[model samples]
Target: MTTPAPEFNKKLGFINAFTAATLMGFVGFFARHIDAQGDFIAFSRMMCGAILFFGILAYKGRIKELLAYKLSIPMILSGFFMGNCLSAYITATQHTSIANAVFFIYIGPIISTLLAVIFLKEKMKPATWFALVAVFIGMMMISGLMSVGPNGLSFGMEFSQETFFGDMMGLYSGVGYGLFLFLGRYRTEVPGDVRAFWNFVFALAGITILFIFTKPTISQMTSTDWMWWIGIGIVCGFGALGTCTIATRHLKAAEFACVSYWECVVAALFVGLLFYGEPLSSGQMIGGALIIIGGMSEVVISMLGKSLKKTDKQADAMGAL
Candidate 1:
């Protein structure tokens, strides 16, 4: 298949990333309402996602891509990182508020941006930097970090015994997901479906290995649980990751990381609209707006800049003529 033009590919990536992130937000619903532990939640998502991806690949007659996929340190680590982050984030939601969990998880972009600079040797535009700052502040507001905590600093993050473990898990998820994004850059040459297939397979494998060591007893899964679990797997796991593959393929990790905040904003919305009882304040509303604006602002600015530059060049050419 012929590659798309660089400019068009970037736009396509951005749009798909936005959609994927929005779809990913629904996982919070399952995380919040499901009675299962984080292990089970993660296991179900990865397992079902892998099956679905495999089936699709087989149907599309692209299963050879899966077999042709070479496992390297980067590939293995990327999948493992995804497994770690998904499990940790779900675990955080099991104990803490969804907003707080999302806030912590969104920090992955920060780490991803940094890794992009160091290893990927990528640079961000001034507009992107501004959007990132705006989104991050908004995330903090949504997470209630606007309130004063034990520290005089504005971090507003305070830990209690009940939420300490969950909060830590969220924070670690940020790190794991950061690595996942950075590693995704390596798999861009592969087909989007193939990339997603490997991601689910490796993530499921990692989680399974973890379960082997720390065996947890299973609880009875109601029919409702089964339905929700499969739905989450298809939507948030297969759908989200498939779209994410398209995004990461065309855009650098840092370039798309800021826009990924759409996930947090959408997740917050689900909490507000669905579970209205989740602790909320006016600050959350403002934060949600900021995140949406920040996510879009970069794209607008980039397009506008290109237009202006083209116009200027045209004017100069006409004057010369």
Candidate 2:
């Protein structure tokens, strides 16, 4: 198959990333009615999502590759870590503020960049470094560091014990997500669709096991609970598809990294509008703006860099002629 032109690929990638963001916006709506058993909700959502995704693959005759099941250990590890991250995050929210939870969760790119620098031996661009710094500042603000000004300082700064726990969980989730991203990059032998399918499958299986050990029963769940589960499946599952479509088709590893950060922005707006029934706080609004700006900065800079190199090459060709 012929590869698409670079410009076309970039456009396609942006579109895919945007679609993922839009789809993920609905997750907050579903999350609001989710009762006490957040982990159970997560398990149900992952299982249903896996079933829905695998069903599509099977219908499309992609089941052959799946049946061959050449499972990559890294991919499976990524899924396991991701599943654990989900459970941790949900558990954390039970103890912490959502603001703290989400602020720390958005730290994925920073963690991923750190990991890439270490394990992957990847060199980040100047813009990427700047973006990371921006994100850190944004996170500090989101975590309510700014609330400690004027009359001395509030020792807790706006973070409750629950918020701290939530932040911790979010931090681990970011690490797992980073690992997932890293593995997805290197596991080139696995087809994108197949890898995504298995990631969900493994996550579902792991969470299911966790649920079993916890002795979770759906008998206690209301119809609203079921509705949220279905919504989660639709939002996160199809959101993953949208992400894969763009990342696989058009984005380089770095570009994909940048695009994925939009998930945080989308999630914040969604949760605010749906649950809080209030506009995002000034801090959240500002922080989200910076995050989005910083996230896209890398992609924009990379595109410009690529364009400049192409122009230089063409000039050299003309000089030779």
Candidate 3:
């Protein structure tokens, strides 16, 4: 018999969702520190993650569930897009300015929203629209597209031909991520472990194949690099993605969309303060504020809606009695 899936709890879901987003921000830390090429880093992360998740399934005697689970179209696509999203994102970090890469990839929620509306026919509530717009503005400000200068606020990105390829890769990562999230919403029945296991497996396989054509030189990694890869695999790959999959199972599209932008704030903080010695700018700080507010607004709206509906049910029951 297949192992039964766990029941969803809103509180646990929200906590896991937040943790997952926060962990995602650490990707740049690894990209900056590790000596390997992005593809190699991606491959290491996926291979190690696949091993860890596989071990988890085997140890728990849930390997049967993984094998027995049907591979639906949505599940397959989710895995494919997820593989590409991680690969492209890490590569983008290496090539482009981190701010540019972060900005482009963070548009994921917008793409996710559009797909959800079109395919799933999810209702776009007013609050959802506001949240999306706020997140967009927050990302732009944090990305330095709109900087506050000595004179005042300045608008317009001075486009450079140099970063074009990296910029496109970053955008592609966002689109791929959006597709991944959309497809994830439909595969709610799949156990998080099973889904994560397949994600790592597919990503590992896909990257290995791509390496054949590119044949880029992978620099020799130090013992420290291997150590980071292992830890990141367990933490960022397994912990982050596992919780994210769980969050998708529990949180509705409108509820968790803004909340996931925690990645932007955390990423900016880690890169700016720790590595670059750059202090938070007025725009980044304000952008961080907008992200927090936008995310909180959606969560509060969802909670209020739920509470009102619950009270209405209680009132109806009392009237019937």
Candidate 4:
């Protein structure tokens, strides 16, 4: 069988990453309908995701390969970080305002860029840095930090003890997420499905331990709750995460980070339409536009840079002949 073209794989990877981010945007909606403690929801999500992911592998006749794949220390660490990131973000949302939690969590992209530069020795273009700044400002606008009010866009800084703790957790969650993405990009030897399966395994284990310790009230869930849980686990877990894992193979960690910002835009649209049933503010529209433009521009510029380099090399070879 002929191998697929490299450019085709890269394009597919970009689509996969964007699609996964869009699916992840629905997570908050599902969580809102679950009526469970944060830890319980997290545990269930991971456990269910793992089961479904394994089931998929079984159906594909790859279960044995997944199970037999050697689990390296880095893989285990990545899974642990992934679990911490998800759980911390959930808990942070419970304690702090959703805006605060989301804004802090979005710091993951910046962290990912820094880590990629330091460890992977990836060069950051000035254009990419400008794009990142634009994206950050856009996210702040979407978070309503720049909303005009009676005080006229106050940049007040006040944090209660609880909020302070939650903010710290959010920052930690960003760190964990950044590390997870960096590791995934650095180590591409593992198959995406196998890596995703192991990630769920370790995440499930971590969350299960937390559940035992915290022991949040286990109330009876309605059929609706179960439906949401299944969606989060099977659909978001297997589908979103599996595709994201595949994406890491074709995109740099920094590029993937920029692409993932679409989750915020998607989430904003979803929350406005499904929950609020109201029109978005002009600020939100502007912010979302900035994010999309910045991210897409960065990716396009990077790809063009690569294409130019390839052309230059071909021209040089012809000139030498």
Instruction: Give the Cα lDDT of each candidate.
Output: 0.77, 0.64, 0.77, 0.77
Order the candidate numbers by TM-score, best to worst.
3, 4, 1, 2
Candidate 1, TM-score vs. the true structure? Answer: 0.85
Q: lDDT by residue for model 2 over 232-256, one digit each (tens)?
A: 7667654554355335345554556
Question: How do the residues 183-258 of candidate 1 rate in per-residue lDDT, one tens digit apiece?
Answer: 8887566776777777777898888887876475556677787788777777887778768767877777755786
> 264 in model 2: Cα distance from truth in Å?
3.6
Model 1: lDDT equals: 0.77
- Clash counts per candidate, in order, are 0, 3, 0, 0
> Highest TM-score among the candidates is held by which one?
3
Query: Which stretches in model 3 have alpha-carbon errors above 4 Å?
Result: 1-8, 150-152, 216-219, 274-276
Off by over 4 Å in 2: 1-14, 67-69, 142-171, 241-257, 310-321
User: Against the true structure, what is each candidate's TM-score?
Assistant: 0.85, 0.80, 0.89, 0.88
lDDT of 4 at 66: 74
Cα lDDT tens digits for candidate 3, 89-173: 7778777887777777777767887888888887878877898778778777877777778988776454478888888889989
